[model samples]
Target: MLTLPNILTLSRIVTVPLLAALLWWPGWATGYLLGFVVYSLMGVTDYFDGYLARAQGAVSRLGIFLDPIADKIMVAAVILILCAAGNDRFPPLIAEVHVIAAMIILLREITVSGLREFLAGLQVSMPVSQLAKWKTTLQIVALGTLILAGGFREQVWMHDLGLATLWASAILTLVTGWDYLRVGLKHMD
Candidate 1:
């Protein structure tokens, strides 16, 4: 139950509040820089946790359950933080039309989670699609780059690039999310 991979996953869950604290003050560029480093480390650990689990044949039910939960928690936290206002240099990522994008991602996550739970209860497995993986990758890059943009306030380009990625991810989110829903609906009744 307490394998190294699980420990790493648990560490990410444990440290999210600290991550939120770092982002609490938007004016704190130093804090944002540190948050970026911490966020990057969390991403690295996310990779290794699964890699080590598979390589060592240490995968467990606990690991399978916690991994996605940790990921969602981290992503949600960062999104909510970035959506709030504070720094003049770094505006809210979810401002104006971006709110629709952000809401799309959030809504998809909730919908898919509920669908997964329903399928699980029916003893049906809904394997992740390849495009879903791409959506996850785009989302991580979008959020990470946005956080990094906060650290580099002078680099408006970073913010713009981050916004670009955010919209791209949102587009992917809609596609993958609808795919999941289509499959899920088939098993509904």
Candidate 2:
């Protein structure tokens, strides 16, 4: 259904490409700033979509299905774009070692998605956990901060803070990922 919540989620899925394009050029500081603004707006929409759905009792099956997909698509696009944007630069948006962190996050996302799909077939719902929520928050902040850092290239601290949170979020990602995998395996043959 095209409820307001569903509409908000749809907006996020559609905006991801624009977010990617904005981050395509790392040196375009102004573009990065604008990208940060866009990213923040997307995040706001993400929160409201779910909240409005719950508050209004308008949580349709379509909304549930599309919500996480939108989130994964957004995160994946941002990570891939940021990693790609910095490959040739001395200090890329996502540094060389930090790419490992990004990879970990990406791998977990794919693996969990598959696990969730398998569980869905069994009529089992794997709701997001508290720890996973924390991980998601950190991941968002890490990625957003990195984008913000791009706009203020001279503020090396922003980049450093971003990297620090990236690593922290990656660690949390592994923990929560394992938790999901453990739950998933229990349903396996």
Q: Judged by TM-score, which candidate is best?
A: 2
What are the clashing pairs of model 2?
Answer: none
Tell me each candidate's RMSD, in Å, in order: 1.3, 1.1
CA lDDT, candidate 1, residue 86: 68
Candidate 2 lDDT over residue span 57-170, tens digit each: 999999999999999999999989888886355257886788999999999999999999999999999999999999999999999999999999999999999999999999
Taking all chains together, each candidate's TM-score versus the true structure is 0.96, 0.97
Number of colliding residue pairs in each model: 0, 0
In terms of lDDT, model 1 sits at 0.89
Off by over 4 Å in 1: 87-90
Candidate 1: residue 50 lDDT (0-100): 96
Runs with alpha carbons beyond 4 Å of true place in candidate 2: 87-90
Error of 2 at 42 (Å): 0.3
lDDT by candidate, in order shown? 0.89, 0.93
Model 1 error, position 161 (Å): 0.3
